[model samples]
Target: MLSRLSPRTWLLAAAVCAVLAAGTSLVYGGARVQPASWPQARPEPIALGRPPALPWPSHGQAAVAVAGQAGTLRVYGKQRPVPIASVTKVMTALVILRDHPPGGPSIRVDRQAAIESGNRDESTVAITEGQSFTERQLLELMLIPSGNNAARLLARWDAGSEEAFVGRMNTTAAKLGMKNTTYTGASGYEPTTVSTAVDQLKLARQAMKDPVLRDIVATARTTIPGVKGEIVNSNKLLALPGVVGLKTGTSTPAGGALLWAAHPTSGDRDRLILGVVLRQGEPGDALEDRKKAAFVASRRLIVAAQRSGWAKTR
Candidate 1:
């Protein structure tokens, strides 16, 4: 009966068989189609631009200021105020130093400062109420270890309240030409407290000018009497060669950031770099990388200076 069909019927049967074959193939083949050679896909290429007159600022909100005997490089990030984390303590120490130069009567830790200890997850010097440390030691605690208790203690000692002390911080920043900087608290835990990298570079440059500030930040280990034992500078860069003085900051909102300065031993010139990464995925590692990158970049600036006869290479 199949062989006896007319031409039109045969054509119809052929079409039906074709449809059935296609359906069978689809049912047995599964949804995924395997490609030949695994199909190497090319990613869209990024076009390179002329490198900026300066090295590109580290990714994210960053500003850099490098001035050695060689020359100077300044760059600004998007002008948005962002929390600076413990970098605020740099200004705190500056105001403290400005109000009470290194060698005055020592300030004793009070209850207010002690109360902040181990709270808010802030870094501390473990200062106990009634413990007495020199203003110099406290400054080390504030800048080196980023001691929150030390900041509160200094604020209490200087202005009788952290609030009033923050006022002084803003005032001091304004005096130093940090137009975009503002301080809500000396501890820098408040997200509302913010500053720009450009502003931080100004404060860092000024802080580096102070011999006392320079000495405090350069010290890798300091002995501050704690409730139990001694506290030390937590800044790792202190041990790194060519690093003179600087600060590090981190918070949930601020991510990891650093303001750094380096001067070659042989050269009278120095380079300053401010790096900030907001909302980084891994803050601790990110900060270390930023520091290492800053060191390399600053060293490059120093070498450039030497090549230009701006600095002498020993």
Candidate 2:
């Protein structure tokens, strides 16, 4: 049969034989191959450092003020020039109260004041032009609601022009030992409004000493009639335990910052500790982080005071 096969058949048969041989070799080669082995070792465990003794404020720049009956201590960062947002009103309110005092004549909001007030921003106390409100109401509007209009109105009332009033702000800050602080506007909307965490601490401490300022800041809610409607206090931290009162600030550039004062219900207290954080995160988150940082620092200070016999137990 092999001799009877044609050349074509022979070629086909040879091809089939070759394919069969390749398949057999492949099968044997695959079976003969063995997996490689590796050396085994135990995984190392990671060691985390000790947690911070005190929780630090999460914001970029944070200032905390804790007041008691005793002395005060303030820790802050590089006294740099950064926008303060609505916190500029702190100085405005102080200057206004100093000039007008509490229960003084009412402030009339005019066109210029309203025009210079609010802008496209996250927070504002809308006050229309031609609105009339008491000096006390204006103070509340400035501090409680952080009304930009209120700040501008008070500034205009004080110095005749917002630019001149900012000059006054710088002058006042200098007098108060806030060497690093500077003001370009009453509402801190301008990026030129700058102060350090340390300088803000100084300002907060001074503001806290004023009975009227303290009372106004501690207030959780207030009503102030405006040209269009009534304004109300918006600082939610007033309701928090141990919170006295201070101020909250926010801006796109400055981030969310706060000057907070807190104290235990009873004690030979400590003076306020002021903390300021610049260029933090979102407004809400930054405020919360600053509060937490203030709480932690205050608690630590309280404990230290007790241990060092600085604060007497009730």
Candidate 3:
């Protein structure tokens, strides 16, 4: 009977048989298979144009860029690498976190770190020798107060020596495409440790990505258990409307340097703005005065960025 069937009938019967066989296999397997889901396409990022004019600082190299975006909107002054002062701590924090995360092991304050704390010429947190602090607390001491001693302690704890840690800083900078950056010391005390505003902005973006570092930078003030008083953030820009966490650097050669982050709302989107201002004020200016200049320049640039529609939403 099968052999005598018409060709069309035979084809239809074969198709039916195939379907029945598939169903039978599924039944035996005790499950019915559903088609795999196709991934939904992601929305394209919004493209933004640089404004015709921004309040670029007259005396320094500065650049403003959106986080996750390549390149910057506008840059001012010479792009050559210049001393970045304590802004070098951003990389120090970043490298330390990369090795030992926020909740990692506690570190003891060595004699050198404790001795360095008494140096009035550089920023320091009063932590005694043999006193132990968690990685997170050390970061707060280093970043919030801009403590040179705390930064070096973190470097030594992480890499056994400041030299080795600085090597890692430069390696990480190179990996992040900060081509003009160089790290000669864990603390930005050495005038030889240098970078451009654009390069520091790149570091700012990376630094803000770590949740611990992000929180530490945004904190206005905090007190450690053994510390004498509250440690206040050095980045005065944090008081600004949209300004958040970042680092500040000031020295004779570095002048005043700031790697800053802000989240300003444009339309319905909260945009992350990362900026770097370097070499604000004359090298001969006092450290506090120079740092104030960086803060002023940063504030102007941030406000201008919003007014000029630099932070756009799709």
Give the best candidate by lDDT: 3
Model 3 spans with C-alpha error above 4 angstroms:
1-52, 70-72
Across 84-103, the per-residue lDDT of candidate 3 in tens digits comes to: 99999999999998998666
- Candidate 2's C-alpha runs over 4 A off are 1-53, 63-77, 114-119, 226-230, 269-273, 282-314
Model 1, 2-82: lDDT tens per residue? 779899988977875675545433233467432233222676564322113444435545554444222343454576778
Q: TM-score of predicted model 3?
A: 0.82
Q: How many clashes in candidate 2?
A: 19
State the TM-score for model 2: 0.68
Instruction: Write the number of the candidate with greater TM-score, choosing between 1 and 3.
Output: 3
In candidate 3 the C-alpha lDDT for residue 45 amounts to 66
Q: What Cα-based lDDT does every candidate model obtain?
A: 0.66, 0.65, 0.84
> Each prediction's Cα RMSD?
17.9, 20.8, 12.9
Superior by lDDT: candidate 2 or candidate 3: 3
Q: Distance from true position, residue 122, model 3, in Å?
A: 0.8
